[model samples]
Target: MANVIEEAKSGRASCRTCKKTIAKGELRLGVEQMTQFSDTPSMQWHHLLCAAGKLPGELKGALAGYEGDVPNRADIDKAMTDSIKSGKAKPGAFPYIDKAPTGRAKCMQCDETIEKDSWRVAVERELEVNGFMRKSPGYMHPKCVAPNLENVGGTMEDLVSQVKTNSLIDEADMDAVVEEMTGEGGGDGGE
Candidate 1:
C-alpha cells in the first residue's frame, strides 16, 4: 500500500479508466479508480477489490466476465439502510422500528400537518412568575420530539398553559378497585 502522505507530496495522479490526472487535495478512496503514467512500469491499474482479492465469489460469479469491483456487504447494507431512512424504500425490509405511513395528523394546538407517527401533546403550564402567565410545553411523538414546540399554535398554547397548573382529576378510585372482574383473584368466591 502506498503511503497517502507520500502520494500527496508527489502530486497529481490519474484514474486508469478515465486517464484524467487527479489534482492535489482531491478526495479519493482506495477502490476509486487511479492510474500510474510510466514508460515502463511493473504495477498496473487494477480494480481495488480485484487487487486486494476481497471481491466475494458469489458477486463475482454473478458478474461473469465483468472485472470491476462490486460493492461489499457493508456498502450494500449502508445503502439499503439509507434508502429506508430516507423514505425512498417503502415496504423495504428495514430491521428498525416498523413504519406505517398514515395521512398527516393536525396538531390540536398549532394545526400543523404532522405525520401520523409524529404527533405531539402540548400540556399547558399554570405556574406564573410575578403575574399570572400561561405557556404550553409540547410533548412529541417518539421520532419527532426535537421540534415539537416550534409548531404549536396560539389556541393550543393557551390550552397547554392552562393545563400546566391543573392536576389530572380521575373519577375512578383505582385503589378500591378489584384485582379481577372475572373469577380469578378472588373476584367471586367459587363453590
Candidate 2:
C-alpha cells in the first residue's frame, strides 16, 4: 500500500527508474502507484541504487522502516543526500523552480532557450499527443512565469506559494526566483 523495500521474489520486474530487470533476490524499492484501471494501487519497482537517485525521499522513508539488512546502506544514504542537494531529486509535483540540467528546453512563454545551470520554472501544460491530450511539465524562464500564468487564468500569488512549497532549490536560489516572478528585484523587466 505504501512505499517499501523488499527482496525481489522473481526477475520479472523491471525497474521504473532505470528500465532494467531486477535479478531475483536483489533488494528493490517498491513505490505504490495508482492506476486508472483499478482502485487498489500497484507497486512500481526500482533498483535500490536507482531508487536512491530518483526517488530519494520516498526510498528514505521506506528504508527507515525496513528491518532487513541493506547492502551498501551508507552509499545509498550518501547518494540520496547528494541527489536532494543537487536538485536532481524533485520533492513535489509541478510548479517548481530548479536549475536547468541542459539548455535544450525552450521557455514555453517567450520561446527562448533556457540555458543550462540557469533558474527555470516548471508548470503543467496540456499537450495533444497521438490524438490524446496529456499533461506534462512545461519549462519557462522565471521572468516569463507570471505573464504566462496570467494569460492562462493562473494567478501569480498562487504560483509563488506553490513554487515556494514545491521547489527543492536552496534559499538563495529560491529568493532569486521569487524576486524575478514578482518584479521586486531587478529582472530586466522581463524584456
Candidate 3:
C-alpha cells in the first residue's frame, strides 16, 4: 500500500489503468498492491489523471506522500473530485473505456477488434470461491453492449454517464465515443 512518483525508465511500461504509454522520463504515479501472481507486492503504474479517475478515494494519501512533480495537478484534482462524487461505491465495477488497460483485446461479444483510442466497454464477472472474491474482465465494442447487456436495467446513456464520472475522458471525446458506440455517427470512427 505504498505509492511513489517516479520517472519511467523506458517506453515499455504503460499505465495499468489507461493502457497508454507514459513517455520515457515522464513522471508517473506508482501504486503498490498485492496480486495473486506474486508473493511480493508489485508496483502498478498510472498516469496521474488516470489514477484519479480509477482510484479517487485512495488518491489523497498517494498524493500526500508524493514529492515529485505532478505536471497536471489541477486536472488530477478535478478528475478525482468527479469520481469521488460519482457515489457508485465501487468504481472499478463500473463499465468504463480504455478501461481495463488490456493492450489488445478482442470483444467477447462480436469478436471484433477494439482499436486504441476507440470506445470499448469493460464488464467484470465475479467469482466467489470459499471466502474470497476474484474478478475476470471482459471487453465489448460499443455496438456490442446492447446484446451483451440486454437485460441490464440501465440504458446506453446511463453507461456513458457512469463512464464520464469515473474516467478521464472529456465531454467532447465522450460525445464522439458515444456516437461511434451507438452507431449514430459514421462507422469510420471519425478517423
Top TM-score prediction, candidate number? 2
Q: What's the number of clashes in each of the models?
A: 5, 0, 0
Per-residue lDDT tens digits for candidate 1, residues 97-154, read: 2122454544334455646542233333344657966553333332332234334334
The local distance difference test score of each candidate is 0.31, 0.81, 0.68
lDDT of 3 at 35: 90
Candidate 2 matches the true fold with a TM-score of 0.57
Per residue, candidate 3 scores C-alpha lDDT tens digits across 3-85 of 67778899878998889999899877787889999899998888878888887744655565577768888999888878866
Worst lDDT window (10 residues) for model 2? 182-191
lDDT score at residue 72, model 1, on the 0-100 scale: 60
Clashing pairs in 1: 110-153, 124-160, 124-161, 124-164, 125-161
TM-score of each: 0.17, 0.57, 0.45
Off by over 4 Å in 2: 1-83, 86-88, 151-153, 186-191
